[model samples]
Target: MKQWKLGLVVVLGISGLFSGRAIAAEEIILRYGILERTVAVSDLSQLAETGEATSQLQSYFDTAEVPAEEVQNMLNSDVTVDGVNINRILDNPLGDVLLDEVSKSIYPESGSAGRQAMRAALVLSAVDDDRITVIEVLENYPTSRVVLDTERLAETYEDFQEVGGVVVTVEDTLDDVLNVIRILETLSN
Candidate 1:
């Protein structure tokens, strides 16, 4: 009787472990730009947990065939990473409007892809016209957030004299950027 009980307990434990993994591996739609990516949520969580700086989530973004230079520039900018003070730039009326506009554009009234796009666009729109002259939003990590320095990117291009509204379908706003980071931190926990 004791042996049977022990065997049953072991089997249950193994089953529970597999079940947990399956749950983690469940497919989830990650939105960035005008794109909806169906991938394993567990994979994103794993990338976040490992503290891998590289956007392992890029594979999903690639489906949209976004320009490589644009993506690279956005990643290299300040908004892409964490621990940057964007409070001053984002705390303005224009900044707020920019975020709202992007939100509406990407989310629209329906469609999962549209909603995801809007979510991504919100952050893309926040790029400070002064700092980030140009921008490119790549991926959305449910566990980790990325911000685009649109203001800075604009500066690099001579044609873009004024930074605002230069990068279409990108969310580079300040508050939006911070909010996404907050979400990432929450997911990480």
Candidate 2:
């Protein structure tokens, strides 16, 4: 009788373990740009809580195929105004956007200075743009909350000149870049 009880207990414990993994496999909705995707809840939770989750998201952005030539040129080149790196002038707030616009250009097809031109265009567009500013970032278990400074972002862009001569480095992985953009977009909305 004692042996039978022990065996039943072991079987139940094993079954519970498998069922727990099944529960974790449940799906959740995640939005990227205009696309909505159904991903495993476990995957989303891991991404929210762990820094290691970046590798998975990075693979998703690699599909854009920003040309190797453009990436190389931008990495080697410096953006300087009066011999100071443009990034030094901006002090980092707009660094991500500047880098993304320049490094991700499709190259030769876009023209000899397409990357630089694209970077310029992005800076110009941000002038009249009204995206919200992030105020607070919060993570609560499976849910995350981000508060924005809507009023400030609604004001006209007066800081464009600060980012005008910015230089970008492709030091970050493509996935990391995309992750930042997604997070910024999420907060802005």
Error of 2 at 43 (Å): 1.1
List, residue by residue over 1-189, the lDDT tens digit for candidate 1. Answer: 345434533553465366442211134444555555554434434443452323545655456555444544433343322112222333466545444444332222233333333223323323322133122222221112223223333433333223233332234565588899999999999
Reference-based TM-score of each model? 0.27, 0.19
* Model 1 score (lDDT): 0.37
List, residue by residue over 71-163, the lDDT tens digit for candidate 2: 223222222232112223233546545443333321212134433333332322222221111110101111221111212221212232234
Question: What overall lDDT goes with each candidate model?
Answer: 0.37, 0.32
